[model samples]
Target: MAAPEQTPAQYVPIGGDREISDRIEAYLAKRDGVDKLLKISRYASKIIIASSLFESQPLNSKLKSFESSVGVTRKALRLGKFLQSFNALKKSSELKSKRDFMASIASGGEGLYYFVEQFVWLSKAGLIDGKHSSRFSKIGAWCEFVGYVGSISVKWMDLSEIGEEKERLRSESDENVRELKMMELEEKEMMKRLSIVQDWADWLMAFADVRDGKGPLTSPLLLSSAGLLSALISAHKIWVSCKA
Candidate 1:
């Protein structure tokens, strides 16, 4: 599903002397962990109220239909006075999942084993879709994920292996476009057509930034993904010539 072009939605600002909103904000402000937020907002009403501190929707929808038929406490309604439950709607699902996924990955060192497990768990749990799901279908996504985490992506897998996988992913993405295009033949569909390519490009650039054991202050040297196999062959070509 496509994201709304509108700016991210947020809960209305808490006014002075408002207690429920203030309590929820104080409670949620301490919850830097999305897992906790997911649990708290598992229901649409809580999701609507607790999420005012940030821009997001509810979580793990199948956790219960309580998600849609959220019983708003009169207390909550009185506090916000303009909140929408947005229940039973899939419109916010994509946003919900991505927000959860990014927050999960922000740890910066979850390692490969945990990373794969995290991807599988998040996807199987239906916590993510759209780019998140499509990325799971790409080798580049895993490769890029290691960049965000630590050096869990050891230098052992060959470029040839990754290249072959990439070729297969490109073909799959093209097939997806062909399948989707028939359903949108009348629309301009600019984003629908370009999103896959853009996603792959973003993944590749992100994955190539191997810090090469340098400190945070150092320029990154693309770490070879495989011992003596060199994922850096292509990256090095551009690195040696670029003035950036």
Candidate 2:
């Protein structure tokens, strides 16, 4: 899942009466916009492939091929994505002075995940031996799962802090001040909740990967649904950030 911006939410303009082409251009101007759309399409294809509607072998084969193509393209787009996690790790480490274990787990694990993912992408792209793909994928999935665990823990802690701050602000005598602060906290809370949900969704997919699609819980339908959910949530965050 794409990380939501750490900045506080603020009002922003969006979707004016501009031409559809212009709106699309504005959206694609953001680096992650195309990737998010591809993610949605990739997972949507999986859902179709898993569904009973595509029972024919030929149709299913085509759908799977399309999904594979989209998945590979998405990976290509994330060629340097590890830098994001690395930068976050550096900043978080500086701020926490090495005492925040969860922070390290979140950013460090994600960095490792993305770093390892490059080889997996290469395997998929036929630049490396296909035999290493499974091992690389499993390692990446486990790292992603660990990263999400830390990420969710950190977000929950932030929500707890926000809740406490809101409690303190509730007693403020100034009506305007209270309302403004409350609104800000509410927005923050909403974003945090959305992020948590997205992480959980992504975590499910990671778990499926780690399991190598073994159990009923990791069925194609479940995995595809989780991926689609995470993709949509990511798209939502990116669109809102673009508007901002």
For each candidate, the alpha-carbon lDDT, in order, equals: 0.35, 0.87
In candidate 1, clashing pairs total 1
RMSD values, in order shown: 23.1, 11.3
Q: TM-score, each model?
A: 0.17, 0.87
Tens digits of per-residue lDDT for model 2, 93-178:
75553336788789988998988889999998899999999999999999999999998888889899899999999899999999
Please report the TM-score between candidate 2 and the true structure: 0.87
**Candidate 2 C-alpha RMSD relative to the actual structure:** 11.3
Best by TM-score: 2
Q: In model 1, what lDDT does residue 237 have?
A: 28
lDDT of 1 by residue, 1-244 (tens): 9976997788775664476555555544432222223323433333333335334444433323553332122112223211221221223335455433343333322233233434544553566563574344244235444433322212112223444544455555477775565444323233222323333333343444333334442222122112111222222322323332
